[model samples]
Target: MPFAQIYMIEGRTEEQKRAVIEKVTAALVEAVGAPKETVRVWIQDVPNTNWGIAGVTAKDLGR
Candidate 1:
């Protein structure tokens, strides 16, 4: 089995979430030789306030 873990700021649309899973599964099937059914994807969503980059939070990106 192949496993993928994706972490990102929260507030993604349901379609976006589904796309993530589908793409990861396809990659695992093609690259890792894992069956689509055996590919496992785990998504961890963090709040904007909890995610920071270069001393700026995701919420700060809009500014």
Candidate 2:
């Protein structure tokens, strides 16, 4: 089994997230020859307040 954890800012639509999941799953399947059913992907959507860049929060950066 192959597991992937993806972290991103928390503002994408459901469709977008679905697309990401599908693409990531496909990548894992192709790259490592993992079975489609055995590939696990977890998307972690972090709030802007909890995400930081260059010593500033994403919220503070208006991201």
Candidate 3:
């Protein structure tokens, strides 16, 4: 089994998130030789206010 956890600042469309999940699953299947059915992927959408970059919040950076 292969598990993937992805963290990113919130605000992406549902389509984009779906793409992320699909692509991640495919990548894991290819890289680790895991069966597609055994792959797990989850996305964590962090608020811009809670995500920091370069000592500044993503919200403050206009992310």
RMSD of 1: 1.4
**Clash statistics: count for each candidate:** 0, 0, 0
Cα lDDT tens digits for candidate 3, 1-63: 888999999999999999999999999988989999999999999999999999999999999
RMSD of 3: 0.5
What does candidate 2's lDDT look like per residue over 1-63, in tens digits?
999999999999999999999999999999999999999999999999999899999999999
| Candidate 1 deviant stretches above 4 angstroms | none
Off by over 4 Å in 2: none
Evaluation by lDDT, superior candidate among 2 and 3: 2
In candidate 2, the residue pairs with backbone N, CA or C atoms under 3 Å apart (3 or more residues apart, or in different chains) clash, namely none
TM-scores for all predictions: 0.89, 0.96, 0.96
Ranking by lDDT: 2, 3, 1
User: What Cα-based lDDT does every candidate model obtain?
Assistant: 0.88, 0.97, 0.95
Model 2, TM vs. native: 0.96
lDDT, model 1, position 52: 88
